[model samples]
Target: MSGVTLSNVVKKYGETQVIHGVELTVDPGEFCVFVGPSGCGKSTLLRMIAGLEETSAGEIRIGTRDVTRLDPAQRGVAMVFQTYALYPHMSVAENMGFGLKMNGHPKAEIREKVAKASSILHLDDYLHRKPKALSGGQRQRVAIGRAIVRGPEVFLFDEPLSNLDAELRVEMRVEIARLHREIGATMIYVTHDQVEAMTLADKIVVLRGGRVEQVGAPLDLYREPDNLFVAGFIGSPAMNLLPAHPTEGGIHVPALGPEVIACRPPGHVSELVAGFRPQSLRIGAGDTHSVEMTEALGGVSFIHCARDGQPKLVIETKGNHVERPGTDISVHVDPDEMFLFDKLTGHRLR
Candidate 1:
């Protein structure tokens, strides 16, 4: 397994620059994910590493070789796209070994590789089935098996689960995670879904507006985000950011209550934004806000609360407790659990 490295990588289409100077390194046998909103340069950067996109500037190295100007085939990387892209006419085994066949490999070698890949992906039973005869998940597994047969140094997945239903997506996620563990191959996955990023990545690169906002392990990014964007984007349902003002001894949050939260702010900061995860908040004893909605998902519930002129807040509660719409309630959050950001620059106060 070979590590992938990007040094000040840049991409541009004539005068339009989409990917700015990006610096990243995926350790050998590491599962790295590039995650962000739509129009962010995650996919573009992945394509650059795969040699699918031209690198306008900077160096890209696979292991020690500079592959910046190399073709996709020469980069020792295999990409699985969002679509299965299977040939309707070919059997699963045929599809998996087609690349080797096209490249002049002997039939015996193709069969051996295909067999091994099929076993690894649990596609042994469906090897003779055509794409039309298989389920969406099985088709995707075939696509993955095709890449596995190549034995590339790196595996690149471009939202390969986007086409699957929710149940199939979860099932495929487990399969992909298992595949990574078994093969120990360097994998760079691109997805706009934070849930996938959180569950699949050993390291995640959060990108936005053609630049990287932050990069770290999943829990590290979740527990301590670098900025407002990351703090809001990393968590499910997102962090609740409310307008706040620094007072003499603490910060005053208008949405929560009139009581000032005892948290120190930077000396020069005037306007501040306070962040709290839904799980960190609770329904307290006063009528500070009205319940707007409740999403009860069996064992857990998310109560959406709102107040006039204040940003809506979602509070996560356990059990089957449901808050009625228009029900008056107060939200409480510990000051220690609160995240502070400068409203002007959107930078963390830490």
Candidate 2:
């Protein structure tokens, strides 16, 4: 097992720079996930570490060895991509062992490695079948098994479950989690899905526009985002960011009536934004806001509401407490559970 490190990493395509100075370290045997919106450079950063993409500047280290200039094959890493990328004609056993075969390993050794990978991935039953005969999840497992046979120091997964169906994605998530526990290798996974990052990572690196927004444990980022972007992007349904202005005693919110909220930051400030999670909102009767939509997901429901001059807000509530669209409702905001950010700079206010 080996840890991965990037020091002041940068990437550029001609004069257009896609990745900013990035500093990160993945501890040995830790599962690290890179998550962001599309075009955020998460995939680019992953590729750079895998040696599939060149680094314009900075050093990448796999263990103690600097791999910044090494060839992809020379790096002690395995990559599982979004696509299965399996050869249709090859059986599972052949596909898993093909890398070893090409590397000039003995036939017996190749078979043993293939068998071990197959067992680890629960692919022993499908070894005789070709990729065409397998389901999407099964084929992905075969792709993973192929990586396993290489005995890589670090595993790189670039949205490996994006191709699977909803149910299959869930199953694959469990499978991958178990595989991580069983192997205990350093793994770096990149995905745009916050849910996946939340569930699968020992540390989550949140990125935005080629810059890393925050890096920490999932709940740490969720509960204590460094800025407004991290606050909004880390959670499902997102944190509700409402426009407001600082008052003498509290922050004044038009929608919440003449009564001021006593949640202003220390010192004098002008414009501010109030943030709170949807789950933190408690529904009540009022005429200030109106429900726009309701999404019931079996046990929980999300109430999408619209305030007169503010952005739309989603409130998470029990499924049994579903409110109809156009219903007049009010939400209570707890100052202790709320977050405050500077409206101008988008920086969080402590």
Candidate 3:
């Protein structure tokens, strides 16, 4: 029962259905992440599981109990929100132990739990400090420590690290990853950030417009997406999609050139979109393109290129230099690295 389950879950506000039938299960002690762009219903799903919002239909179960209609406190889950939601007036220790104190636990026990969580989160040095007195990352740790002190069966994080600066966000991401391992508590995290999902999730659920796109391991979604949405949404810099016409044995990408490259769709490929990761788009001798612009990251580089009269294409590189824009050049893509989707369904051709 330490795990969570949603059976055909649906949510609505008046006439508008925000969540479609969503059937989901989180294995005990599993770290599951729900990721999507803004307004994709990822947060709504998390809140529903936290018992904050009512389900218009379907059932929600937590730890073997049907908690669909239960109060938030009765769900045996603790949530860390994007806002941190800390008590400005209370010190770290008091803030963390407040729930236990309100629930009428013994003073000594509440203090003990707060101390243990603070120790775990390394909040001991700031136990007496208030929220405003802490740095962004420190306050976030306090918020997580508060959730930890609850000792709930499941932890729900709703973009808890979104407010942090980029550098701190990565730091907190690693901390949360380590925390999940240390506690071994089942976690359901929601984020618009793909990096977080990729790094933290034992399983990642890619949601779109209230429906579940696909759920799988981080690399599984990256390497093999079931639909165009999942394919484009799961990776960094996003996957590059180049429309093509289906040919006898392969696809003819007129945008790239006149050649009809011979290749087979991934297993089960049918009506869907064609796709390729930027890293799969290669340029060098034998393969060429007109470089529109070049961006260099410390560890990698990207060339924004296109054919003589084609739309811009993105290619990843670390050492290659790009030519200027408006120049005609040849280019090639790896058949194994390429992706194809049904023209009509937007589902992966394979």
Candidate 4:
């Protein structure tokens, strides 16, 4: 296993910079996920570390070797792309052992390595099958087995499960976690899916506009997002935001009329946009919502309500509840769960 370090890294295409001065460290045997929306440079960053893309200026080190300008094969990193990228004509075993054979490893050693990897990924039964003959998950496992037989120090996955259906996605996710545990190699996974990041990462690096936004454990980022972007980006139903004016050391919603324009000031007080997750706000006698619609998803339901004529609120609730259109309903919000963002900069107050 090996650690990866990027110091003051910058990636540019002509005059346009796709990656800013980025600095990050992936610990040996740690599972670090690079998660962000599309065009956020996550895969690009991974490619830079793999030496597939040359950094405009910076240094990349794998273990103790400074490999900023090294070719991909010499970087001790293996990347599994979204596409299976398997050799169509070759059998699973040949594909898995292709790297070893090309590198001139002994025939017996290649067989032993491929066998061990196939056993680990449960591909032993499909060794003779070609890519077209295997299921999606099985094909992906063969792809992973190819990476495994190389015995690389770092494993990089670029949205590896995007092609699979939901059920297979979950299965592959668990398989990756198990593989990480069994092999104990440094892994950097990139995906736009928050659920994947939340479930699979030991540490999550959230990115935006080609810059690092926040890095922390999954639950920590969920609970204490660094800014409005993160607060809205990290949750399932997303945080509810409302325009309000500061009043009497608290916040006021003039649109809700005089009586119900109530909520104490949040801890991170600033000339801010007040925010709270829809899940954290509750409908109560004193709290309020202007019911617009409802969306039910099995045991859980998404109650879409609004205040005045503003955008609807997406609230997740346990069980179905009947509601009429445009009916006024009260909702309670816990002050501690509220997040405050500077109106102009969108930066968090604390």
Q: What TM-scores do the predictions have?
A: 0.99, 0.97, 0.94, 0.93
Tell me which of candidates 1 and 4 scores higher on TM-score. Answer: 1
lDDT of each candidate versus the true structure: 0.94, 0.91, 0.86, 0.86
Worst ten-residue run, lDDT, model 3?
265-274
- Regions of model 4 farther than 4 Å from truth: 253-270, 286-288, 322-328
RMSD of each: 0.8, 1.2, 2.2, 2.2
Task: Give me the candidate number with maximum TM-score.
Answer: 1
User: How would you encode candidate 2's per-residue C-alpha lDDT over 85-151 as one tens digit per residue?
Assistant: 9988999999999999999999999999999889989988999999989999999999999999999
Q: Ten consecutive residues with minimal summed lDDT in candidate 1? A: 257-266
Ranking by TM-score: 1, 2, 3, 4
**What is the total number of backbone clashes in candidate 1?**
0
Q: How close to the true structure is residue 242 of candidate 3, measured as C-alpha lDDT?
A: 74
Off by over 4 Å in 2: none
What lDDT score is found at residue 265 in candidate 1? 64
Candidate 3 lDDT, 1-350, residue by residue in tens: 29999999999999999999999999999999999999999999999999899999999999789999999999999999999888898999999999898989999999899988988788889999888899999999998998998899999999998888999999999999999888899999999999899999999999999999998999999988998889888888888877777677877776666777788634454444567788887665644466677777757888787766766677788764555656555677787777887767776655
Candidates sorted on lDDT, descending = 1, 2, 3, 4
lDDT of 1 by residue, 1-350 (tens): 99999999999999999999999989999999999999999999999999888999999999999999999999899999999999999999999999999999999999999999999999999999999999999999999999999999999999999999999999999999999999999999999999999999999999998899999999999999989999999988899999998997899989888888886667899999999999999888989999999999989999999888888998999999899999999888888899999999999988
Which of the numbered candidates is closest to the native, going by highest lDDT?
1
| Candidate 1: regions farther than 4 A off | none
